[model samples]
Target chain A: MGKNVLLVDDSKTMRIIIGRSLRQAGIDFDNIFEAADGIEALEVLEKETVDIVLSDINMPNMDGISFLREKSTRDAIKDIPVLMISTETGDDIIGEAKSLGAVGAIKKPFTPDKVNEVLGPLL
Target chain B: MEIQDKMIDATKEIFSTMIMMEINLEEITDVHGPLTDTITAMIGLAGKRKGVLAVHFPYPVALAITSSFLMMDVEEMNDDVHDAMGEIANMLGGNIKTILSENGRDIDLSMPSTIAGSEYSFQSDKDVEKVIISFSTEKGSFMVEMDLEK
Candidate 1:
C-alpha cells in the first residue's frame, strides 16, 4: 500500500483536479483524504495517520496557515510534512508558511511534473 | 479605492505569480468598456458596492494563457476555454474579495461566468468609468476592463 496523503482546498473543482493529478503522479492509495478547509482537515487528522499534507492557502474558517500552526503542536501530526499549494505567491507568504512549518511550496495552475517533483522526495 | 487600482494590483499579482509573466498597464484609446473583451469572465459581487468585474482576454491570448495555466494545448476557444477563463477570474476575484474585505467593504462573490463570442463590443455606462488596463503576458495580450459604481 502506498502512503496515505491528505489534500485540502475549498473548491470542489480544484480538489477533484488535484486528486486526479495525485493519481497520475503515482500516488496510488485508497487512504487519500480530502477536506474542504483547515478545520475539517484537522478533524480528519485527529482520526487517521496521514503521511503528508497537501493544502491550499486560501480557505475559509481557519486557513492553511492556522492549520499548520495547530499541526505543529500536536505530537501525532507534527511529523507529517506539509506541501503548500496556492495562488497567493509572495516571498512573505511563502516564508511565513515555511516558518510556520510547511515542507515545500507549489504555486497554483501546476503541471503533473511539478506535483510529482514536490511529492517525489517526501512521499 | 478606485476599481482601477484594485485591478492593476490584483492582475499583476496573479499573472506574475502563476504564469511568471509581467503585465504592463497602458490605457487603450478605443476603450471597449465591458464588451471589449473577446473572452470575458465575470461574477456578481453583492454588498455595499454591487457590480460585475470581468477579466477579458483576446482569443489567441486567452487560448495561450488557458493552455499554460492548465498544462494543456488549446487549439481554439470552446467550453474548456470558458471554464478556464471562469477559473482565472475566480482566482482574481477571490483575491479581490480579500482586499475589499480588509478595507471594511465585505462582499459575497458569486461563481464566475464567461462570455466568448464574435462581433461584440462593451462600453461602460455614461456615469461609470470604463477603465481598460492593457497587459501583455508571455503568451499574448489581454486586459482587465470593468464598469462599476457605488
Candidate 2:
C-alpha cells in the first residue's frame, strides 16, 4: 500500500509549495492531508491514516513543538514521525524539536533535492 | 560576511530555489523614497533584538513572483500574492533571526503581514540602523529592508 503524508502549515502558499516539492522529489503518497496549524494537524492525525507528518514550527493556533509534545502523550497517534520543514532551524530549536519527537528537519528556502535528502530516508 | 551581505544571499536563495526566479543584486542603498503601486511584506523581530524586516515589491513584480512561486499565472494583486509575499518575508525574517540570534530561541518572530497601496512611506519611529538592498529580476525590481533598534 502507498504511504500517506500530512502537511501542517498556516500559509496556504507554503502548503502548496511543499506538496509541489514532494512531487518534484518523486515522493508520491496515496493521501496528502493538510492542516492550518498543530490543532488541525492533530485532528487530521486522529481521523486520517497518516504515515508521516511535515509540519512548520511557527503557526497561529498551535505550533509544531506543542503539537509534537501533545501528540507524544496520545497513544494512538504518538508514534507517527514528524519532520519539521520550517525556516526556524537553529540548533537550539531543532534540538528541542528532536527532544519533542520530531524525526528530522528541512529549513525553509529549501530545494526539492534538500527535501529528498532529508525526508527520503524516513520514508 | 556582514549582515547586509547575508540578507542579500538569503533573498537571492529564496528567489532562486523556491520562486524559480534568478534575481541579482542591483543596488545597496541607505534610503528609498515613498513607494507607489507596490506591496510590502513585513515581519517583526523581538526579544534579544527588536526591529522589522520588510520586502517591497511593485505590483508587476509581485504578480510575477507569485505566479512563479505557485507555478501558476498570477495577473493581479490578490490574497495569493499577499500570502506568497508574506511567506517570503517570513523566510527572510527567519534567516535574519539566525544571523542575529545564535540559538534562534533568543529572538521571537511575529506573524508576517502585508501592506499594499498606491503610495505610502515606510519608516521606523524609533532610532534604527537600516540596510536596504535592491534586487532585479526579469519582471522588475524589489527591495529588502531591515531596520534594527540601535
Cα displacement (Å) at residue B111, model 2: 1.1
Q: Give the TM-score of candidate 2.
A: 0.99
Measured with DockQ on alpha carbons, how good is candidate 2? 0.89
- How well is each residue in B12-125 modelled by candidate 2, as lDDT tens digits? 899889998889899998899999999999999999999999999999999999999999999989999999999999999999999999899999999899999999999999
Quick one: best DockQ, which candidate?
2
RMSD to native for every prediction?
6.9, 0.7
Candidate 2 clashing pairs, residues 3+ apart or interchain: none
Tens-digit per-residue lDDT, A73-107, candidate 1? 88887878889987545556667889988988877
**Per-prediction DockQ, in order?**
0.12, 0.89
| Candidate 1 Cα outliers beyond 4 Å, as residue runs | A6-123, B1-3, B28-30, B33-37, B103-105, B123-129
What is the lDDT for A31 in model 1?
Answer: 80
Residue range with the least summed lDDT across 10 consecutive positions in model 2 chain B: B15-24
lDDT of 1 at A40: 90
